[model samples]
Target: MALISDNDPIYELLDKWHEDDEYEKILEKVDEIPMEERSNKLWFRKISALNNLKRYDEAREEIAKLSPRCTETADIGRLFYMMGYIYDQKNCEFKAIECYRRRAEIDPSWDECDEWVNDSLGYAKKDMDRAYNAFSRFFPDYAEKNQNAAEKKTVEEPDILPYISAMGSSFMSSNLGVKLPLDQPFFKCSEEDKPKVVSFLTDRMHITDLKSLQQDFGRNRLAPLTSNILHIIETGEEPPLDKLNAQQLTHYEASKLLLGKMKEFIPEGGLAAWDYSDMLAIARFMYSVDMLTNTEIMQTYLFANDECKRLFKSWEEFTHSLTIGAFYNAFTRDTSYNINQSAKFAINVGLFCMQTYPGIEWLGEIKE
Candidate 1:
């Protein structure tokens, strides 16, 4: 085989730690290796990934591959312990306790094995009680099966899906701008006469009557992110730049109004998403909403690259009219987790304005 690249020394260090008793470090090293061909040390790497990623079955398959000629004095009891840890951490108490027993059986003389088996059994017993008490899917195996499904989807295509979309973490949190009830309740406000609520500032921080505190949190409007985007595409109402203060926007970057997208009216067709992206060129003038940089870059040169343009078009089609999803797709860092940004708010505001404005069609209802 060709001599391992200059990166071999790094991999060699990782290989040394791969089977070390430090389970967390072993996982770190496993992650350090690229996912493409982890099979070289695939056995241990898979073990570390599965245990941490909560794929117990796959981890077991990898552990099986790590076995030697036979279970001798060299007894891989430590590996068994890790398996137990994985199961127990996921609250599969019975399986965890069973694995612990198997580990102790393999190495009757090993002190670590004894301690591990005891500690794991303790956790298993407690979790078993709690599992009976609350009786919920807390032990969902913490299975990242949904994320794995998304990963599988992206691997099958050159057009990788944005991480936020795959993770289903829409970007609705970031745009609301200011805090409400941030002091006493950490952004929660209570009305003594009103009922309990799950989320405060349900859509945007608004002053509605406390009587409106129904189970729905009265979030009758589009998500802030969505409304904001619609606002941008339609009305061009930007965050008040005067609010940014003096130093933030200076002589070099003068305080100016937030620019909106310019759309051409096609008479019969109404308005089409302008293929020309002047929004990006006038980035300085346009409100730099969260993830605006990414969207700007994406929109700027996307059409120039044949593959990228096609992928974008496909994404646009997939997210057509679902402006919320599309804007979130680009604003998010990774789809696997929810983003706290509100870039979609501008889009929502834009679209809302467009629908309500003169000569614009209303496909959906606007509140009375």
Candidate 2:
């Protein structure tokens, strides 16, 4: 058989085989690769295959050969640790302990072997629970709540569950190409501003490409002057604008000043936790660019289309507003990557809220 290297198509096929748990095919791919190009990763895969098939002796022999040859200290440490697991599984307690100690000595940070060392004789109920409930990391707080519920111990819940739930729901809707409910408080805009926000999003600012973005907002629209103003707003300091002549005020500067002026008209608490200029910047960026096409995706907006028209007041206008501006506030407020996973996270938040506040019917309306 002709020997192949890492660049060969066989690697992809081997990856597929590994994913499918086809241990035999994995060994076959390993065999096809030349010995010179067969890195420690491939060798580990081969050992893993042997162990999966219960060929303990063969696995040990291969590990023995590979151990001395491994140049990377990390590889040697992991290799010995895995070998320890194999021995432990085989009921060779002494041999497993020896391997575990050797691995620890080689790599001081490899504390995972301590689990085996502490419970070498057998795992306790706590260890079993930890292993079984490894997925608790996804919903850290809720997982704790669930554990408390199981223990019949009451756990104090958080107050901002509705906001978290809404955020999570919106996030999921974004990924699944589904639109969130438009009637949510996060999307509260006046009837007069509705048409303007919708038109700005669907027609004027519905940017799908770089060309359109640059065309609508010039390439240097977010100039240093705008940055200066943003810095002042952020730091609560007045900039020395009088030093600059009228001719020095560029379009970007004027736009930023207008944004600052617009802040004065915003209703009390309407722009809670966010300045008008900041929201304006977010809105401009979101409406003027499509995240899927942009190389650097800062935010992903959940767009509303005809399918979800019934959920809105003026279906067409509300649909566009929901797609364009409504989410700008929420996505900007949320520190999550996007609305999908955030929305999924809301499931736990909503549940936690319901448990804490038993009678609030509106809090449970996170789905709508």
Error of 2 at 173 (Å): 76
TM-score of each: 0.26, 0.31
Clashes of 1: 34
RMSD of each: 24.6, 25.5
RMSD of 1: 24.6
**Model 1, 224: alpha-carbon shift in Å?**
61
Q: Which ten residues in a row have the lowest lDDT in candidate 1?
A: 251-260
For all candidates in order, the CA lDDT equals: 0.35, 0.44
Local accuracy of candidate 1 as per-residue lDDT tens digits, 1-368? 23235454655665666455455666666666564535433444547656766677777776765665235543466676666677666544334545555665667676674576467546544533332222122112112232233322221121222211211112232332222211111122234312222222323323222223222222422233333444555665655556542223221111011111111101111111221121111221111222124544344333322322332332222222233232333323122111112233424433432232212111211122
lDDT value, residue 240 of candidate 1: 56
Q: 108, model 2: CA deviation in Å?
A: 1.5
- For model 2, how does the per-residue alpha-carbon lDDT over 1-368 read when each residue is reduced to its tens digit? 43344466766877788789899988877877777777777788889888888888889888987887788888988787778778666654434555676777778888786677666434322322332233233234433454455334221122222222333344333433333242332333344544544454457546544354435344323223344555566577865665643223222232333234323222222222122122223333333223223332222122111112223322112212222222223322342112332223333333434354333211111123
